[model samples]
Every structure is written in C-alpha cells, then in structure tokens.
Target chain A: MSLKSNVIGALILAGCASLYGCAGQHSEAALQQAGADFQKVKEDSNVLRIAPKDVIRAGESLARADRLSTYWGSGSDVVHYAYLSQRYSEIAREHTTQALNEERAAKLELERQRLQLALRESKLLSVQQQGKWLEEQIVALATTQTDRGLVMTLGDVLFDTGEAELKNSANRVVLKIVQFLQLNPKRVVRIEGYTDSTGGKQENLKLSRDRAQAVADVLMDLGIEDKRIQVEGYGDEYPVDANASERGRAQNRRVEIVFSDEKGQLGAAR
Target chain B: MAVLALAGCASDPAPNEQFRLTEQALEQAKAVGATADEVPEMKLAEGKFNRAKGNMADQSFKNARMRAEQAELDARLAEAKVLTQKSEEQVNVLNTRIVRLRKQLGDAQ
Candidate 1:
C-alpha cells in the first residue's frame, strides 16, 4: 500500500477511537459555540441577554412526545426534526405569552396613572371655586380629625337666639354644606349641638336637639340619604369654652360637624 | 470546502438581519412608553428564539435532515407588538378627539 493511503487509514482509525473515547466531549464544544453565539446575540441589542439554555428538560414532559413523533426507518429523521422543532416552538410560545402579559400589565398601569391625573385635575378645578367660598366663610376656623371623622367649624350663624330655627343668612352656608355633602356622598356624619352656660341645662338640651335636627333635616332635604346621619345635642354640657363673658358665650353656642369617613368599596370596579 | 462554504453562506448577513429585525420590534415597544431599557426585552426574547432556531438548525445538520424550519415565534411576537402599538395609538387619538369635542361643545353651550 502507498504511504499516503496507510497514513490516512491510521488517522481515520485513530480519529474514530478518540471520538468514541470522548463521547460527551462534543457537548463541551457545543457549549462553547453556544456561548460565543450568545455573546453575538447580546451585542445585537444593548438589552442584557440570557444565554438560551438546553431547556427541553425545563419544558413540560418532552420524552413521551419525542418518542411518539419519532419513528424508525423511513422518514424517521424527518419525524425527529419535526418533534424537536415543535418543542422549541412551544418553549418560545411560553416566553412570548409571558412577554405579552407583561406588556399588557404595563399598558394598564400607564392608563391608570393617566386617568388618576385627569381626575385630580378636575377635582382641583372644582375645589378652586369652593376654596374661594371657604376663604370667606372660614374665618377663625380650625380643623381636626377624630375616630369619628373630619370636623369643620361652622360658625354660630346657623341658629337664632335661644331657638334652633335656621337663620335667614345661614341659608348660604347651609346650601354650601349641602352641596359639599352631595359631592361627597360616600361619607357619614354626626351633628353635635351646644349652647352657652347662661341657658338652663334642660332648655339648652332642647335647643341643641332642635338645632341638630334642623341641620340634619337640611342635609336630608339636600339629597343626602337619611341613614347616613347621627344627631346628638350636648347643649351646655359640651361647652367648648367658659361662658364667663360674651366672647366665650359666642364661642360656646355653636354646632360641631363631625364626619365618619371610611374608604369603603361600595361599588369600586375595575 | 463544504465546511468553508457553509460558514460563509450567511455569516455577516445574519447579524445585520437580526439587528434590523430587533430594531423593528423595539420601535413597536417604544410606542407603548417602554423605557429604553425595557424596550430591549423584546430583543432578549428574540435572542432566545434565535437560539432555539440555531439548535433546530444544528439538529438538522447533524442528522442528515431534510429541511430546517425557521422558528417564527420571534417574528410573531414582534408583529403582535406592532399591532398592539397601532391599536393603542388609535385609542389615544380617539380619546383626544373626544376630549376636544367635549370642550368645544361646552364652550358653545
């Protein structure tokens, strides 16, 4: 035999032996190729890329399907390729579905923020008018919060001398309060009436009751449901200040507006 | 000769093609206010799709395969994003028009 033929035969025999001796070595080279290819994939976009792993195992139960699709002899390779292709397609589909869902969630969040901004702007405009009115009527006023709810000071203008009858000038404040209540219907209220110590306890109690009922009645007439109201008359017992002088008496004879506002999901819908 | 021929078949062409397709998908992501960082998630997804495709190609090459099917999932994802962006644009335009018309009507009234 020629030397060239002999060398070729030896090399072929040795190469086959080495290839068999190192059965899993091909996978190391495959991994290297995959890593190099993955680097190229990362440079394609500034976005970080995760190396695609051999996730056929990560896929749900590929063995049975792989066997079923693959047949021996004629068209066996065709069926095998088809089987693997289907698996890769399925995995790709799962990733795509996850991505689409994320996109949808992001869009929904953006829409929510935009709607909230619009709502806030409208509320701001409405409050601008109310703020002007509040500026005029809110002289010497203070605000406080309790377990009961937010309390706003309503001056002594809502009542008459020793009588709970609504004063003529109190109509504006009454109507404004009614409008405010109507705007915020998802709220509860308690009206506490008080009187100066100059009045007897019984008379003060009666005056306080009548005044509270009058305010509650106005609110009811203004379109607030009756169930939302709780009225009480403390009269002279709950005097905010000592009735030693006219100024103290003026302060004592007043109504306290208490609201019990809880954020309830009555009809909040998505 | 066969190895060299196969290597050179679409080496440079493949990178450019992938970049172009990825940019196309990124533009679709952009319309939805995806930050530049978030926008490239599509490319990452496409890279996975590409790897799946490469594995599929390798399998065919080794097994004396008949024909390799190109994975269409990345393309489909890109297309879906494009359609989504278009629909969102349409909705935004409609909302703007509605707001404008309402304002005009209020002024007229």
Candidate 2:
C-alpha cells in the first residue's frame, strides 16, 4: 500500500476508536444509578451491621458494572452486573431483617420465661402468707393442736344449767372461730357436747344433743356453710375429770370443737 | 419465481415461540410479587424482553433468541428473589407475635 493509503487507514482507525469511546460514555447514566442503589444499601445501619458481607458483595458488583460500562462499553454485561448488584443489595436487606427478627424473638422468649417464673414465685408467696395468717388466727383463739385436728373447749359456764342456749360471753370466741373457718373454706369442724353424771342417761344425751345443735346453728348463721360442720352429743362419755367434786363435775360438762383435715373430712369420732 | 419467493420467506424466521415463553416467564414472576420486591431484576427482565420483541419485529432472529434467553434468566432470578422476600416477611411476623405474647404475659404477671 502507498503511504497516503496507510495514513488514511490510520485516521479511520482513530475515528472508530473515538466512536467506541462515545458509545462507552452512553452507559454513564446506568452506572450512576447502580452506584446510587449500592450507596443507599451501604448507608443502612441494619444492613451494614447484620449483613456486611452481602453489602460488600453488592458494592463489588456495582463497581464491576461501572467498570464494564465506562471502559468496555459492554451494554449487556453492564446491565447484567447492575441487576446482580441490586439483587445483592436486596439479599442484604433480607438477611438483616432475618437477623433482627431472630434477635427479637429470642428476647421475647427470655421475657416470657422470666414472667412465668415471677408469677409462680408470687403465687407461692401468697399461699405461704395465707397459711401464716391462718396459724396466727388459730393461736389467738387459744385452741390446742391435736392429732385429730385443732380443738377448742368451752366450759359448762358457757350455757345455763340444763339449757342448750349459749351465753353472751361465749359469742366472741365463736365469732373468732367462724372467722377462721371463713378464711379456710376448705376446712370442716365437728362439735361435741358433754354432760355431768347427775342427770338421767337419756336426759343427759338429749341435753347434750341440744347444745351441740345450738352451736352449729350459731356457726351457720355466721356464714359457715352447714355441710362444713358435724355435731355429736357424747352424754357424759369421755369425761376429763372425776364427778365427785363440783369443780370436777363442771369440767366434765363441756362443749368441744374440732377442726377437720385439709380435705375438709372430719377425723375419727372420739 | 415461486421458489425464490418461498426462500425469501424462509430467510426471515420469526421468534414467536421464544417470545411467548419469555412473556409467560415474566408473568409468572410478577404473579409471585417480583414486581414489588425485586424491582431491579424485574425491570431488567422486562427491558430485555421488549428488546427481544423489537429484534423479532426487525426479523433479526439471532439477536432475538439471545435477548429472549437473557430475559428468561432475569425473570427466573426475580422469582427467586420474591420467594426469599416472602420467607423473610413471615419470619418478621412470627417475631412480632412472639414479642406481643411475651408482653402480655409480663403484664398479667
């Protein structure tokens, strides 16, 4: 070829290279958009903290897209890389969301367990307080704890001779016992009445029965349910003292109240 | 003369089947929420699909086939992204429920 033709060919080659450079410049807008998307993802604190690796991958993909668009003018390749960059950013967001949700669930589970434990502890404390209160009330009534149950004895003076009506002075002790029964609704009681040896056996038995029934009536009127009380008249049986002296005979004539077991079942008959 | 005319028709092979397949894939992706969460991938797929249709209109069978194939891949990627996003949302909802239950229990206590 001649020098002129060679020079002309060189000029044509340069012109083609410049035209390719112009085509490369056309991808600038797409590159800018990809860069903006990647920057937005990187700026998200959650993505940065929880999905740093994914964010880095997105940044790398965006850089590759920018390079392909600016240097090679590879339109198809640039678009593919940009799409990949966007997908990576979305993946980073998904991972960050998952991490945050898992953390929250774990915290909630811990809180639930703590609340359950606290509730159980509080219930136990309440039960213990109730038990202590019941014990204090029983002690205040001057009752005796026995194998059968708690027992309180009312002397013969609580009633007029041969009459079943309770005296006014006995009302305070009966009211206290009723209060205790109300507090422990699950407990039942058995009331027993006794008489001295002076009366006929049948009459003594009838009198004892009347007195026991009267005490039960008073308890029922005070709000204790009828089903929770059992009455028995011993009729001079199981006397606590000899009947020879007046004081001993008085001791023999008494009314006794016995509390029941936890299941509300009264113990064996005396 | 008739043979020559037939030959001319054969030279311009239409990419009807490939175009239809790409369109179906795009529709499937959109039905699965690709349009909302996977916007970038869905847009890329749509752009490639439209370009493929343009190539088909110009009777450029080779270019049309290449673009249709790329579009299908992009659509499939978008569908996968939608699936991932749905699972992530479910996890978030479950976490919120657990938190609410815990709060209720605490308040009751």
Candidate 3:
C-alpha cells in the first residue's frame, strides 16, 4: 500500500512539472519579445529624448520579468511583467512620434508666417509699381472736367445687360480707382449710375442703383473706406447721347465716377 | 514551498490605487478622441481594464495590478496616437497653406 501511494505521488509530480514546463516556455517567449521591444526604443535617439520616463519604466518592467523568469513556478508573473514592459515600450514609441510631429508643426508654422510676410511685401511692391502707371491711365480716362468734378465714365459693357453685377473685365479699372483713392486718401468719389430708356422707370431706377452699389462694394472690398464713396442712380436721366440708336443708347447707359479735388471737397450731387 | 507561496499571496496588498490610475488613463484616452472601435490600443486597454476589475472582485490582487498597469500604458498609447494624428493634420494644413502661398508668390513674380 505504501509503494502504491509513492507511485501515485510521483505521477502527480511529473504532471505538475510538465505543466510548469509549458508555462515556462510561453513566458520565455513573452520575455524575449518584451526585451526586443525595449532594446529598440532604448536605441532610438528620438524615443530616448522625448520619452525617457517611459523607456526607464519599460526597462524596469523587463528587469522584473527577467528576474521572475528564474523562479520555478513564477511563469505567470514573468509573462505579466513582460507584457507590461512591451506596453511601456510601445507607449514610448507613440510618445516619440507625437513629439516629433509637434516639432515639425512648429517649424512649419514659422515657415508659414515668413511666407505670409513675404507675400504681403511683394504685393505692396507690385501695387507701388502699378500706382505710377495707373496714374497716367486715370489722367487719360478723365474725359471731362465738367461742373460735376473730374468725371470718368465706366461704360455699360462693364456690366451684364440689365444686371447689377460688374464683370471681371472691369478689374483693371477698379484696381486703378482703388490705387488712385489709396494715393489720395483725403479725396472722395461719387458714383452715379444711368441706364438707357428701355425698362420701366422704377426698374431702371433699381437696376441703376444696384449697379452703382456694386461698384461701391468692390471698392470697399479692396480696402477703401465706405465713408469715402457716395452712390447715386439717375434712371433714364443724365444721358450723354440720344436714345435713338444702339450706339447712342450704349453711350447713354453708363456709370460715371466723379472724384473730389485734392482737398477732399466733393461736388454737390445732381 | 507551498507555505512560501501563501506568504507571497498574503503580502500582496489590493491594487486599489492601480485600478484608479488605470481608470483615469482610460478616461483621458477617451477625452482625446480615442475610441475602442477606432484605436486598437484603446480596445486592448478597455478589455484589460474590465478583466482587471474582475480580478479585483475575485481578490486576485497580483493579476489585477499587472493587468491594470498594462491597461494604463495601453490607454496612454492610444491617447498619444490620437494626438499624433491631430498634429499630423496640423502639419498637412500648414503644408497646404504653404503651397498656396508659394503659388501666389509665383503668380505675383
């Protein structure tokens, strides 16, 4: 009976030993993997610089796992510490990547600011050069110096038929006016709109007003002050030519800009 | 040997603080827009934290502590990844602005 008990005890011990062996092999693989991860982060310069604390924690956990692996039945403990070590290493890598991206963003922000300043300076230079050339064009465009101040006409072609929207073809003249106003900050202008005798008087009045306001809007958009512009609509009045022919109608349909003198004293509205 | 193992078990205090820390990490990860459905690390963190809670209830202090420690780091990694993605987007925005500025400068010249 004693010998039978001894045989049974030995069988149980063998089973326990094999079970421990399997756990040990599993934990050994985990420990090796964790060690590899730790090694990679430790050697990385950016990870070391950006995530030193995480790297240290990873090393500590790896050491704990390495120590635990030496114990006979501490397989689970070894694996757990190894897992923690791997996580710390992974966190370190992620932290390093985040820090690097932030660093790149900072540099790019400075570059963007520098580019913005450069663009503004370039625009200023170009505008200064165009100012001299546009001055000559303005003198030529001033068709008459009537009692209504120095009047310059923007033709009907600058707008769509019966529409208030100014076409893109008007950009040059608009820019020239904006530059002229900028050069003479004290001077103001009155924009007067007229249409040919085609639509109803009320419709002509609204369209003419809308067209005049459109030009004022573009001038304001280009940094001119709203107080510097006065807008008016004459409907079918203030015709420069008769409405008997298409060419006469075209001449009659126009928006005229009346600039004040150098003293900013605008003329009385018609 | 069995007595020594019992002594080790007796000496292990409950990982109440570690559990609190793990939960806080998980909350921070979520605050940074790290969702378990999106970030794999967040999924691991949530799963491990849940299992660690179960371990704590079962009075398995050692298992609970180990799992909580891993979960905390996993959540932190998730948060870092989300922050990194945001920073990458910021970089891209700056890149696009820079490209536009370059084009405008080219046109101006």
Candidate 4:
C-alpha cells in the first residue's frame, strides 16, 4: 500500500510538472508584455503627473510578478500579478488622458467666452457708427436753409404725381429723417406742401394737405411724437419756379421739412 | 490550536467588501455612459465581475477577491475613457463657437 501511494504521488507530480512547464512559458510572455506596458506609462510625463498613485500601483504589481516568476509551480500567480500590473498601467494612461482632456476643455471654454464678448462689442460699435453715418446723410439733405427755416425737400419723385401715398423709393430718406428726429429730441418740424397751377385751387389744396399729412403720419409711425410736427398746405401760391415749363412745374410740386431751432421753436407757417 | 491555525491558513474569508466595491465601480462606469458594446474594458469588467460572483457562491474567496479587484480597475478605466471622450466633444463644440464668433467679428470690422 505504501509503494502504491508513492507511485500515485510521482504520477501526479509528473502531470503537474508538464502543466507548469507550459504555463511557465505562457507567463513569461505575459510578464514581458506587462513590463513593457508599465514602462511605457511610467516614462510618460503626463501619466506620471496626472496619475502618480496608479503608476506606483503598477510598479508594485510588476515587482510582485517578477518575484513570483522565480518560484517553481507558481506560474498562475505570476501571470495574475502580471495581468494586474498591465491593467494598472492601462488605467493610469486612461486617467491621464481624461485629465488632459478636461484641462483642454476648460481652456477652450474660456476662449469661447472671450470671443463671444468681443463679437458683441464689435456689433455694438458698428451700430453706433451706422447711426453716425445716418446723421451725416440727414444733415447733407437739409443743407438748404431758406428764410422759412432749415428746409429739406421731398421731391416729386418720392410720390406718383397727384398721389398722396409715399413710395417705397423714399424709405432711405424717411429712415434718415426718423433717425435725425430721434437724435434731436427737443426740436420740432413744420411739413409744408405745394402744388402747381394745373389743378383746380380747391382740389390742389386738398391734395397738397393730404401729401403733407402722409409725411407726418410716417414720422409718427416711426415713433416721433405727433405734437412735434406741424402740417400745412399752400396750393399754387408758393412757386419756387415758373409753371410754364414741365420741369419748373415739377419743382413747384413739393413737400418740404422745415426744422425748428434747438429750443423747439418752429418758424411760423407761410 | 495547531489544527485551527492550519485550517485558518487553508481557506480565505468571503470578499464581501471587495464585491460591493466592484459593483459600485461598475455602476459608476455605466452612469458615465460606458457600455460593453463600445468599450472593451467595460466588457472585461462585466465578465470578471460575473466570474467573481460565481467564485463567491462557490466559496472561492481568494479567486473572488482577485477577480473583483481587477474588475474594479477595468470599470474605472472604462469610466475614465467615456469621460475623456465627452470632454473632447466639449472642446470641439467650444472651438466651433469660437470660430464662428471670430468670423462674425471679422465681418463687423
């Protein structure tokens, strides 16, 4: 019975020796691979900076694996420690990458906010410049200052002949006038209309009054107070040119914006 | 006394705390959008966690502890990867907005 037990023990030992022989070779490759992985992560400055504890753990696991590799019939333990070392190295790299990405995102977010603020300031400046340009255009249009006041003419081209409705072609001039009025808030204006001698006196009077009223209505629609405007009609009485020629008659048919003084005192109607 | 010491050395206590910790790590990974379908580390984590649970049931405390520890790290790696990807997307979004703002400022000038 003792001889039989010894034979059985020897057979089991032989089987384990063969199994360990195969496992030893496999674990050697695993250890080398884990060591290479750990070395890569350890050498990376970013990994070391961001995940120092994880790097240390990887080194410890690699050391344990190296110690176990020297033991007989302990191939699985060596492999396990090697795998843990590799995992630690991979995790360290992942943590480093995440930290770096977060840092980049924070910087990008700051840059985005700064650019947005700059764009808003630039847009506001452009609007202010545009307001100044419109003021210049209004001043140029009102260059004609007669005995009546600062007279800005709305020519016949702004409306169809005999039509009181202002045409879309007058939008630019109307917008400029609105802006000018808004800037000079205390100033008032008298809108005077005139017609040529071709029409009957009563009909010409009504048409001229309607045309002047149309301009006042536009000013009010554009947010100018109605109390700041005065409308008048002088039909066929005030002719700037002779009615014998079509060109002179065309010039005679007009609406004029007469600006008040800075103190809101407007000139008396003609 | 000798028999008791021999028995103590022969078997390990149950790794209940390690199991809890590993499960928490897996939950954290999932919360951050890490999925086995996308991240191989998540797959490894889940597989190892399941094997650890089986080892626990079989009273293999040593194997259970080892698997649970590895699984925890795997889950942590997966979570980190997903967070990094999200941060990368945020940086890209910020870059696009900055570019648009720059173009608008240039046009304004």
Using lDDT, give the best candidate's number.
Answer: 3
lDDT on C-alpha atoms for all candidate structures: 0.51, 0.74, 0.86, 0.83
CA shift at B19, candidate 4, in angstroms?
Answer: 2.0
Which 10 consecutive residues of model 4 chain A have the lowest summed lDDT? A1-10
TM-score of candidate 3's A chain against the true A chain: 0.57
Please identify which of the two predictions, 2 or 3, would achieve the higher lDDT against the true structure. Answer: 3
Kindly report the fnat of each predicted structure, to 2 decimals. 0.00, 0.12, 0.80, 0.72
Off by over 4 Å in 3: A1-23, A128-133, A144-186, A190-257, A261-270, B1-10
Q: A261 in model 4: Cα distance from truth in Å? A: 11
lDDT at A262, model 2: 64
Candidate 2 chain A: worst-modelled 10 consecutive residues by lDDT: A1-10
Model 2: lDDT to the true structure: 0.74
Top-TM-score candidate index: 3
Worst 10 residues of 1 chain A by lDDT: A65-74
| Root mean square deviation (Cα) for candidate 4 | 9.2
DockQ metric for all predictions: 0.03, 0.13, 0.57, 0.44
Candidate 2's residue-wise lDDT over A1-270, tens digit each? 223432443343335437775224334444555566677778799889988987887777766665555433355556656666766776677667667766766666676666667666766776668767865877656456778677788888999999999999889889878877876779898999999999899999999889988899999999999999899999988888999999999998999898886678788887
Q: C-alpha displacement of B12 in model 2, angstroms?
A: 18
Q: How many backbone clashes does candidate 4 have?
A: 0
lDDT of 4 by residue, A1-270 (tens): 123432443344345446566335677777778877887987899999999998889888877766666556556666888888888898898888888988988888888889889888988787668767865686689758778777899988998988999999888988888887787788899998889999799999988899999999999999999999999988888898999999999998999999897789888888
Docking class of 2: incorrect
Residue A174 miss distance in model 3 (angstroms) = 8.9
Error of 2 at A142 (Å): 7.6
